[model samples]
Target: DAGITQSPRYKITETGRQVTLMCHQTWSHSYMFWYRQDLGHGLRLIYYSAAADITDKGEVPDGYVVSRSKTENFPLTLESATRSQTSVYFCASGAGSLTDTQYFGPGTRLTVL
Candidate 1:
């Protein structure tokens, strides 16, 4: 695929369990990001990686972990899923340029019970 893609477009899980969302891109972009979209919060960045093995936390990083082991894959893991984490998760990638626009995947809607 030339663009990005996400897995488990819809997910349901019990609270306190771990869930991992997958993100893959073919463009080999240098920057990858994970964000969660909620009704009031809009888009909040959870984590991002500039390149392989270089990851950083974003605005809402608590209870979430991200790893970029390869240039084209960035996975986000929720260590202990909670009801508050229920939202739409989106994975995006972009070039290093500030002018570059991020390309978003379809998104994953997760619900925690």
Candidate 2:
């Protein structure tokens, strides 16, 4: 992926409610992923997909859900927002392998209250 961007750069939501973060890429990368940036955890992968409809869970995917209905769109949803889930979320895409370069989208700042 060469270009990526996220929508609703900042969001505030109440606990137990659902929130979805949108990510779009201009390039058609084979792999896309969602990661959360927290104070202590640094960057933790929430979920990833190799292709459309082929998804997999990552390090911290418990409270999150992801779907890639198209090559350029990957949306991450928080099933039930919680304070612990408050963090900056980033979406990234890569060519195919781990060694390939990846491009990250502008992060979404989510605050759960």
Maximum-TM-score candidate: 1
lDDT for position 86 in model 1? 95
Overall local distance difference test of candidate 1 = 0.93
TM-score, each model? 0.96, 0.94
lDDT of 1 at 76: 95
TM-score of 1: 0.96
Clashing pairs in 2: none
lDDT of 2 at 99: 45
Error of 2 at 7 (Å): 0.8
lDDT of 2 at 46: 92
Worst lDDT run of 10 residues, candidate 2, spans 94-103
Best by lDDT: 1
Report, for every candidate in turn, its global Cα lDDT versus the true structure.
0.93, 0.91
Task: Quote the RMSD, in angstroms, for model 2.
Answer: 1.7
What are the runs in model 2 whose C-alpha is more than 4 Å off?
none
